[model samples]
Target: MHGPEPGPGEGMGRAVLRGGSVLAAGTLVERLARFARNVVLARIIAPDQFGLMAIVLAAIALFEALTEVGVSQAVIQNRRGHTPEFLNVAWWINVVRGVAIFAIAAPLSPLIADFYGEPALGPVLAVAFSTMVFTGLMSPKVYALQRQFRFGASVAITQGSGLLGTALTLVLGVLWQNVWALVLGTVFEAFVRFVLSFLLCPIRPTFRIDRESWRDLFAFTKGMFGLAFMTFVVAQADVFVLGRLVSAETLGLYAMAVTLAMFPLTLFSKVVQPLVVPILAAFQDTPDALRATYLRLERLIWLFGLPMAATMAVAAAPLLTLVYGPPYAAAAAPFAVIGVYTVVYMASMVSFSVYLAMARPELQRSFTLLRALLLVVSIYPLSLTYGPVGASSAMLGALVLAMVLQVANLRRIIGLRARAYLGTLGGGLVAAALVGALTAALGLLNLPVLTLAGLSVVPLLAVWGLLLFRERHEVRALRRRGGGAAASDR
Candidate 1:
């Protein structure tokens, strides 16, 4: 079996364990900080205020997404990705994109605000969107770290900057008690991230352009731009559509649910997605090794994700009410549905990264386009009928369809059969079933809300322990022989 030749300190299993721990720990801390910030801010600020800020963020995301040029992906995937000329060219292109987004968004904010019937959104959006400029100026060397599997600096820059931003947001939220806290906090986080990028990487990009460099960078952007745009539409369509359909207070409740449901996905985005490209790129030349590694990762994601989905689907209402108070409990239903959606979404993410490693971003674009179209077609009608639940359901439907397309693409490209794909999900399904059964049985005891949630996950945890016990031999083998060799041996 052809396999990735693990270099010193770069065994596939070892790299995943080491890098995953850094990214996961950093992301967990950052997410917890943000969660604390939200819990505090939600109490201080009214629902309508959060709704207004959500609109502001959605508009800013739209403008920035339009200009996304896949610079980071390019830097990671290209052979000359770390060269000074290539990095410089990437910086210039991104800076130009950022400036353009700001200029257009600032002027258009008034019209966007008018559409949403919140005239105050105009200024808030203009200020929040300036983050595009800051992010554009960030050093491309951050992506270079991933290419080399060096994650410590990247995690430090991300979590350290994020913690600072969270603290600032909390301070301002206490003082202001309004939507400005959310807007300003977001802008601050971007600015800090940009500054820290330079400090950690210490690579100053000059105003230099090269034809070959531009060609290499822009080559990846073709499908990336489309994929990015489609992803934005899928990501923000619920808020964008529901803001117009429902009251601001209702929209706020829905937005809160989205945050809660997306908790798992947020970690996936920060940790797994970033690692996918560089890790998989190592096996790009060997289809068997690529497929094997991809399946193993997907299986691991499902093992955890499925149980999380089960807990969210069964216990989200009680959990939300327990943590955020009764005022936000209205978010629970949508949270439950969206939580299950996370599994499908994360599974697709693994495949998406595989496609990128193979330089087949167009495939990613195609599936995302399918999702965008589904969302656009279904969101309005669903929101009109079922309110936030319907809106969340619309997104779930769209993503499910897109994931189906992705499975088909995986088969054609890597020869991953449907049966093999289904097999990876089996353990997760069993764990999810155990959680559901345990939750159902626990409901008979008249437990307190939080206690019920706490008990509901017990079976899931046991299942995880059992799975780990079963894998002990493989774990030891990996430690002895290295991850790539051990995996290929299996």
Candidate 2:
């Protein structure tokens, strides 16, 4: 018999470990600074400023998502990505796209403000849309770094941007005591990120646009845009509904709650998702290998994500009360409900890289569109009775539906059975359930929020340790050999 062949992604685990640590450490520092910034800003600025900022942001994202050309994903997935011609063309297309968004969003700011019934929003959006222009100028080399797992520079740039933005926002918020700090701070972050991307990425892109490259790149973007738009809608549905129906104060409170609750989601976006896509792309041609990779990441991420959700959910009331102080005390109930919602929301994100890896982005598009439309139908009616809490529930329901569809889609794509999926993730489910239960029980003890939350995650850590120990072999394979099959399988 042949000696063990090389495992998929062998020897890449060291890179992943290095990259993950860089991203995680930087992200943790960035997040802590941001939390402090939020604490200071929340006190200085009124809730209306946050509500205004959210709407402006949501609008800008809507336009940007609509115009996305899949330039980044194409670079990551395409073989020609390293060629100067491809990078230049993708860069130009994105630059034009960004400019177009700014042009349209700037003039249309008044209409958006009108739609939201907030006159002050018009000016805030005008400044906020400037970020899109700089955002377009970022080098595609960032994707190259991700594809190769050379995230050190990219992580530094991101952390730097976060720190700069937080500091600027704090200073400006204190001085202006309005939304100018938030809006301009965003633009500052975008400007700094673009500068850093060019410096970090080894690619020296030029002005030339290659015809075939544009066609190939646009082809991918055509498929991706619908999915991006639907995702935007799903993500911003609460803002869309509540911005119209609720008070600014109410929207601000809900924003704080969701921000606190979406910690796992933020971490997934900032670190996990980017790494997974490139790694998954490596295994795409081999179905068995792909399925193995998906299950391992899925199960492991579930174990890690479940506890954060449980802790945040159980501790939302006091977390909000403690973090933002008494002014936001009224936000606790909606915060709790949305906390639970966010944990379940994570289910939708699990298979995203799998779908993209399999070149089935349209599946994500269709399912997300279904979810968004369903939310539109459900949210208005729900908000009529349940208020912002009702809107959160509706959005969560959409997420659940989307997740079920993702599982079915994954089955069709890879022949992985649902029973196998359930079996693999059942431990995570149980751990999360136990954490939630214990948190609720301990919450009755009337401890401080930090103390209560700290206590809540103890069982999570224990369960996680037990799972890690049980799966030490596979875990070791993931850590030592990279994110693929077990060492024995090689």
Candidate 3:
């Protein structure tokens, strides 16, 4: 527990709550748009189309991961004085890396197609390479804004562009009735992000590069670069493995499960991650301060994440039917597995952010590497034995191991009590389980889809409400303390 003392008006707890709310709102909008787009695509194209796209995207992700220079994170964490030269040098390096990735991936597309046994993949992959080039040109000023806690504007530009991209893709998919709509949508999103980043963020870079600036940023960027690469591998390993090992239709079903399981967790992480690093950076020097912030964050994460995971687990069948139709009913089991993992995945992510903020980025990188390794070891054997279902189980195992390691590492670093940590998780799990059981019983009785989905929401919301009610005193205390601090600062 070490970091700077929480200032009167700037407690990390309050900042996280406020920031989470803003981020959550933006994420909700983006997820909704994505959901709409996916619903349309699921209906228009065959499952094989998604599977094909998944395979091509996996290769693109790997190349993007390697070429990631991590200059954005470098900019965020550089508490040392920054200058125009630093931004300029980083920008040019990233531009170069982006170009290199496009060059390699474009030529390698044919090879990837050969490996996947799909000749059509070559053109699709070539088109996908453009996303990296556009994303590379995005201003690091966006990262700077995040550091300054100007999240509203950042959310507007990034999430708004994503919504527009999804809308455009859906429209195109309806018109063309093919995978090109989806591919074009992704490219459009990247382009919009690049344009909006520059428009909203004022830090423009000159073409000049400074040698000293490169050296100064290298230590931070190199470690983060490794972390980013590991992140991409862990995220995409399931898709990569399943696409190669299973049929396209099976891979498509698994992909949908992954999406359903990941969307909520991804949304939660996206909202919190940008805010956590800067808040943590500000208090990095004091272990006690960092410990308090970390505990508060973990609790906040469990509060929301556990409920969402529970709701998804309970409503998986009906929700899947409603959104993806009964043809995708096979995805329900895998969706449940991935939903369980989402809890651990979300918690570990927050812990990783705390570590990064504390300048222990190597630890974050180590954990990511471990997760990726576990994924490699688990996915192949499981896919061979149990096929897509086993692959989903492996993903859950990897996430759980990662979460346990993160919590253990945090405790080692700051001496957190095991009972306190488990209590929150156990309570949420129990509550969610009860709700899930109730929902399952209802499903067993042969209720209508709408009835099942509607009834499921009641118990889920009730469980969440009761949990919050029990914690009302703690929430109130935090608010009172935060309010008093703000008045004193004034």
Alpha carbon lDDT of each predicted model? 0.81, 0.77, 0.74
All candidates in order of TM-score, best leading: 1, 2, 3
Clashing pairs in 1: none
**What lDDT is obtained when candidate 2 is compared to the true structure?**
0.77
Model 3: number of clashes?
7
User: What TM-score goes with each of the models?
Assistant: 0.94, 0.92, 0.90
Query: Where does model 1 exceed 4 Å of error?
Result: 1-13, 472-490
For each of the candidates, the C-alpha root-mean-square deviation to the true structure, in angstroms, is: 3.6, 4.1, 3.9
Q: Give the better candidate number (1 or 3) by TM-score.
A: 1
Judging by TM-score against the true structure, name the best candidate: 1
Model 3: worst 10 consecutive residues (lDDT sum): 481-490
Give the poorly placed runs of model 2, Cα more than 4 Å off: 1-9, 448-472, 479-490
Evaluated at residue 66, the lDDT of candidate 1 is 85
Task: Kindly indicate the candidate among 1 and 3 with the higher lDDT.
Answer: 1
